[model samples]
Target: MDAAPMDATALLLADSRFPGGGHAHSGGLEEAAARGLVTDEPSLASFLLGRLRTAGALAAAFAAAATGGGDLGALDAEFDARTPSPAQRAASRAQGGGVARAARRAWPSARLDALLAAQPRPHHPVIVGLLVRDPRDAARVVAYLAVTGPASAAVRLLGLDPLGVNAVLARLAGEVDAVAADAARHARTAPEDLPAPGSPALDLLAEAHDRHHREEVRLFAS
Candidate 1:
């Protein structure tokens, strides 16, 4: 059977070429690489899998909820609560701010204006949810980005083959879809009740990366 048509907004946002400043963030992969935790394809795969289950899942759920609609302030607060590390929260908002700027120019709407009015720098997933609209599509876009950014970082940091990295992403397609599906299931769930899957290791990595970024020259912002 043929695949269902992808939402256009989801496709555009998920594109690596999107001028969303995502290329400057490694989704914590930079720190993981520095620590040798993700030095090779096998290790990278493991890191991506763990990240997908935790941080990725959390992002997907929030994106789904945002797409389904609710109190934007409540959603922002709930998302902030789930992100324990201050550095991680900063990175999220930074990315969100970038996407918001591009989105306002490309797809100006009352919904987008309301979101920015409520929280000028909304969480990345929440902004994505507003842009994409479809719960599953929004979830899938963020969930895909959650790993792809890091995967690309692996290629640049570890000198891994691009083909190999693409293959690794291909291998994880099922997991990504599963995460998006689970997130869509709770699209209309109360903001306070959204999934808050935590990744202590990622949080630590993000904090460390922030410190290192400040003290020395770092390639990616986060």
Candidate 2:
């Protein structure tokens, strides 16, 4: 049987040209590339897979929870606790703030207003969850973005073939769907009970990147 239609909002948010400031950030790929960690298609696939299982899963769960609906502030606080790196947190909020701004103009609602009011710069996944509403769609959007942003950055940073990078992402499609499905299953879980799958390497990379970004010129924000 054919799959259900994709949610329009999820598609829009997942689009690279969504004007959400996602282009400026590399989702830790910049740091990994600078360290010569992700150089080609095979290595890129490994990096994306590791990221999808850890950071991607965490974001997906939070996004799913947000879509399921609960106290926004509590959710934000829980998300904050899950994020160990200050730089990573900053990137998330910065992206979240950007999405929130666009969402205010494109899809205004009391829920959005309240989210911004409580925390002007909430976590990126949280904002996505609020906007998408569908637990599966919200989880899918964040889970997809988790690797795609870094994959795009890989193209620019490594000068690898775009086709090769796209193929790598295609190969990871099953893993992404698995993560989104797992996240959707816990959409209605309590805020504190949400999963916190940590990525120590990514966190370290984010911190290193922040330091390097301050010391010299860098292409992506984080």
Candidate 3:
């Protein structure tokens, strides 16, 4: 199979400025930072790795499942089941809704429209998976986002060196490919059977952030 189309679509959607509103959310990095869980470059790297393995793995799998055109409703429920925190669930749907709206305008496909009609707001990884044709590429997009959001937020919140923060991402490139491949392998599996790696600490942080920052100003949405 030719890889050019898949590569291009993945690159386009992976861009932080993809009009998908991905830049508005910090992927829970802000909350972690406030709690001192991620205060420096080294801490940020650790947090990203943990996320890439847990939430990141789940996102990649779900995106790959979406690529398979499975029952999205079941997929959505499976995704929610994996996410234990209400705050995190809301964040995922909000980001999903943003990505879905942007993708519909950009791709303009019947399948995308049907996905929206089926659910007014789908999971972010699910919508991303539906937009990209290659299951591996879909996984790649979500895995990349898993780190990029927090990495970007770290730069702003901690005033960390941009060069150093990006180095953390570049260092994880191999793992990103590995995660994407692992996720794509299950593209044909039942939605309930997909990987459900969860990060309990991240979920707790998200709930804490939402509970405390309801009226306070924050740099990131989640």
Clash counts for all predictions: 0, 0, 0
Give per-model TM-scores: 0.98, 0.98, 0.96
| Each model's lDDT | 0.93, 0.93, 0.88
Query: Which runs in model 1 stand beyond 4 Å of their true positions?
Result: none
Per-residue lDDT of 187 in model 3: 90
lDDT by residue (15-121, candidate 3, tens digit) is: 98788788878888999999888999889989999999999999999999998878988999999999989988888898889887777777898888888998978
Better of 2 and 3 by lDDT: 2
Which ten residues in a row are the worst by lDDT in model 3?
1-10
Task: Kindly list the per-residue Cα lDDT of model 1 for residues 1-222, writing each as its tens digit.
Answer: 115777788999999999989999999999999998888899999999999999999999999999887887889999999999999999999999999999999999999999899888999999999898888889999999999999999999999999999999999999999999999987889999998999999999999999999999999999
lDDT of 2 by residue, 1-222 (tens): 116767899999999999999999998999999899988999999999999999999999999999877988889999999998999999999999999989999999999999999899989999999999988889999999999999999999999999989999999998999999899987889999999999999999999999999999999999
The deviation in Å at residue 51 for candidate 3 is 0.3
Worst 10 residues of 1 by lDDT: 1-10
